[model samples]
Target: MTVRMFMGDARVDAIAPDDRGLAYGESLFETMRIHRGDIPWWDAHMARLTHGTQRLAMPLPDATRMYAEAMALLDGADGVLKLQLTRGGGVRGYAANSDAAPFWMLSMHPLPNRIDSLDTIWCEITLASQPRLAGLKHGNRLEQILAANEVRAANADEGLMCDGAGRVIAATSANFFALIDGHWQTPVLDACGVAGVMREWVLAQVDAHVTSLKPSDVECADAVFLCNAVRGILPVQRLGARAWPRTHPEIRALQAALAQSHPGFEPLLEAS
Candidate 1:
């Protein structure tokens, strides 16, 4: 992994001990796919990051400078890049530090191994319906952490989560999509769940309906898949006792379309 820390535009040694992001989870982040030292979906990621900062009332780092630094760190590698933006250091309370300079960091990591299919489980953890924080990649993630731990303990590749009302939302780290009645459907994120960049792409490609889904609806679907920017599209092989084919024709088509649109996902089609 390669990392570079920054405060505003100046290089920094480390995060401050009093950083609000460290102390109070007042931050936002975007994880991107790097292809030949460049992020294919950089604009979409930045748009989401900007939305997050606006919602949290936090300052965002300059995008052009941040891009330059990230490219410098990547150095023509095909990998993963994570950009984290924080509220910077603050005093000992929850009040906003209006004068603090925002702190940000860019880190590069090796791409994960290609996933042909996923074995998933229905997690017991449920997401709270906090409309204010919904659909933003905010820093508070205890719910996701616990859900991921459940999946790891069960030896599953991913875990499906739901809101308190029993409406299936998404996976621990990716968005969920189900094919039923010859149409693609995904859960509405107006209440909870991150509006993943890959999910948005898939929605545009398929014209998928943003609707509510129950576990029964998912288990009865003809096909199921999960998606994120890093791993592309992943077919669901098994969830609990219900099982489907490791690859579906519709999923393959979507992957092919993604490959055509983004160079980073082109390799995933070959792996599939």
Candidate 2:
């Protein structure tokens, strides 16, 4: 794993232990798909990161310098790049140091093994409703952590989560969508869930409805799929007792379209 750490604009070997990100989860992160030392959706990822920083009042890093470091870390490899931005180090208290420099890090990870289809479950861990934090990729991810643990223990590929009102929100690490009546419907992220970068691209590519959805809606839908920046498009073959076609024709078309649009997903398209 390649890593580059920084404090504001200066390079560093490691982060301070008293960093707010470590103490209070005061941070934001983005996991990008790197293709041949480049991030095709760099602009989109930076947009979200900027949004989160503004919302949280955290100092933003220089985007140009960050991009250079990201490319340096990737070093022409096809993998995943994770950027974590924190509120910098401070004393042992909740009160933030207004003068503290922002702390950030970039780490490179290999992409997980690709599977053509997925089997998932509805997890018991429900997402907490926090509209202010909704749609941001913050460091506080205990909800997703618990849900992912359940999926791992069940030997499933992933798990779908719901908000307190029982409205389907998203999967543990990805945004979910269902095909119903020849239309694509995804859960609205106004109440919870991170708005994934890949989900943004897909919505831009197709006419999708952002609406409130229930588990029954997913079960009754014609097809279901999950998308994230790391995994372009994933066909969900089974969720609980309900099952879908391993290769839904519509899903294949979507995957092909994504592969054509994103170079990182070309391998997934070839597997189909």
Each candidate's lDDT (Cα)?
0.91, 0.91
Residue range with the least summed lDDT across 10 consecutive positions in model 2: 263-272
Candidate 2 clashing pairs, residues 3+ apart or interchain: none
Per-candidate TM-score against the hidden true structure: 0.97, 0.97
lDDT of 2 by residue, 140-233 (tens): 9999999999999999999999999999999999998899989999999987999999999889878999999999999999999999999898
> What does candidate 2 score on TM?
0.97
The sequence of per-residue lDDT tens digits that candidate 1 reaches over residues 33-94 is: 99887888999999999999998899999999998898888878799999999999889989
